[model samples]
Target: MSIDAFAATSLPVRVGVQIAPQHALYPKIREAVQEVEDLGVDVLFNWDHFFPLHGEPDGLHFEAWSLLAAWAEQTSRIELGPLVNCNTYRNPNLQADIARTIDHISGGRLIFGTGSGWFQRDYDEYGYEFGTAGQRLDALARDLPIIRDRWTKLNPAPVRDIPILIGGGGEKKTLRIVAEHASIWHSFSNTETLERKLGILAGHADAVGRDVREIEISTGVELDFSEGLLEAQHALGVRLFTVGLSGPDYDMAPVRRLLAWRDAANA
Candidate 1:
């Protein structure tokens, strides 16, 4: 579709929680997912990694897609998926099929967030080549359309057009991929960075003949959920705000605060 074909419209503010599966037991992580969902968060996310990204390198960690399958059966309202699945880890067609299966398990609530792999340890330890960033991105750009096509050829097909959330901030390649295939574009951006990137994304979207506004913008915040920062992002057209909750205890305070903020904003 043309970039201008879709009418500009305001989207409802939604809150997501990334329950980081690190330094915590699997049971605890499961409890955290239930707790966050019960608290009314709009989306639940986990990272696609084999090891902890922070704290002790040997900290407790779990795989993302497997946990997502379990979460699919465990929770009812919240949309769930990896914050970004690594494209290099599995075949793109297999990724599509797995996503489709998860969609059915969730009754159509899967959000297929993916990106080119980074984390060198994940590559080295897992025996996958940690190619240059540009090479990985080129692979990603090639695989995305194949993934989407595979979705169509699946036996039962996805329960819905599973929302594709491409997470990254690379101006040239990543944003172009987002423009071409993503239903949601996720990144970690402050107001100024988001504004500039959004302009660049618009150009890319226009180049691809897709509406930039049609791609939902998602960004993450840590413990300090600043209202001012969020308001600035919201003003710049970001609708999805995600907060990361880590390990062991899985604090619900920030999740509650963001949910309240979402309610207030939507109201």
Candidate 2:
């Protein structure tokens, strides 16, 4: 697909930042969240994990949903959620309830991004089974419907049909789930990968009898934006671009660059 193909839909390009909640204190994470919100990004995210993903394995790290609840109260305007919550950690119904509560807490600013669990350490430490990749994906598939059903039965419905963002690039399973359930599909694909995966996604959407473009395309961009990568992906229909920032410093230079790119693209 070319830029013109996506232009008709004209979804405004959005920028989000995933501030890794490892290797830093909660105060620093809070400060970073406030700063990112002040800078006018579209969304804020923290990963769902019990341990650090990089650097020192035993470094300081915080939980995902708990911090999201805190961030919901601390900031206004910016949408927030786990970059992708692990399905292995909690029951699907419980996940729905938790997301709904946070949705209320944030006054409906929550974007419920989730994926099949990947980090094995989290499962072992938490006493959940560290199953095969297929098993986890199968579990996620079985559970997502239940979550949506639970949403209907809740005391007070979500502030809105809280947008579900599904992150992963598995063509066989993950993309199909995105087709069936996700309002936003987040991936770490560049131009080539995105092009191919989107075709697969379209097929999945067809099987499910929905237009593929109804689901927004989200991607993680590299910090080095000098290469025209952003424009290339935009041409292929990706509107939501996010950058991942690690803790300790939580540098904002790249975030500023992404915001600038977003503004120019939207203009």
Candidate 3:
């Protein structure tokens, strides 16, 4: 499907911030979350990882779901989740239950972002098999249904049907899974890359008897929106864009830029 075939541009633009859970104390991370919410960010995300992705390797980093649980209580309005939770770390049923609990805690504000595990060091140190990429993708494919099924069986179910956000742009298995399962699809792509993948995703959606436009398109953004990258992507059906902030000092400037852009675009 061509970019013109999709209706993503008609959707409301949303801004998200990923508070990198590295190189900062827990209080600082929590403070940043509060500050971003106060600044009117639409969504808040933290990565699912055992260690910092950048800066000092052994830096102070906290766990993902635990922090999400904390944030569920800490904020009353903003939606929160892992930017992309690694499917390998916990059982599918457990993930579903945890997500359900957090959804209730947040009064139905969980986004449930997940992806195939990638960090080999995290897998090795955590004693999980650091399998081939295909194998991991296969595992994610198999587990997503189990997670969804588990949600149905839980007592006092999730406050709402949580939106599943799958991140990754692999043309084969990942896009297929996104077509079948994801309510939101996130990718780190420029205009060229995203346009191509939307075509692929449209094909997958066709195969699955789903409308490609039904899935919300998301991407990562930079501090500088002056280049018109965000607008270009928005033109191609991208609705949600996220900016990543790292700590010690989680600067709010980029977040402010994103929010300003979102407001202007929406207006």
Clashing pairs in 1: none
The most accurate candidate by lDDT is 3
Model number with the top TM-score: 3
Query: Where does candidate 1 stray beyond 4 Å?
Result: 1-8
lDDT string for model 1 (35-63, tens) is 98889899999999999999889999999
Against the hidden reference, what TM-scores do the models get? 0.97, 0.96, 0.98
Q: lDDT of all predictions, in order shown?
A: 0.90, 0.90, 0.91
lDDT of each residue in 220-243, candidate 2, tens digit only: 877776538888888888899999
If the candidates were sorted by their lDDT against the true structure, best first, what order would they fall in? Answer: 3, 2, 1
Q: Which stretches of candidate 3 lie over 4 Å from their true place?
A: 7-9
lDDT tens digits, residue span 151-246, model 3: 999999899999999999999999999999998999999889998999999999989899777799999987666538987888888888999999
Q: Residue-pair clashes per candidate, as listed? A: 0, 0, 0
Itemize residue pairs with steric clashes in candidate 3. Answer: none
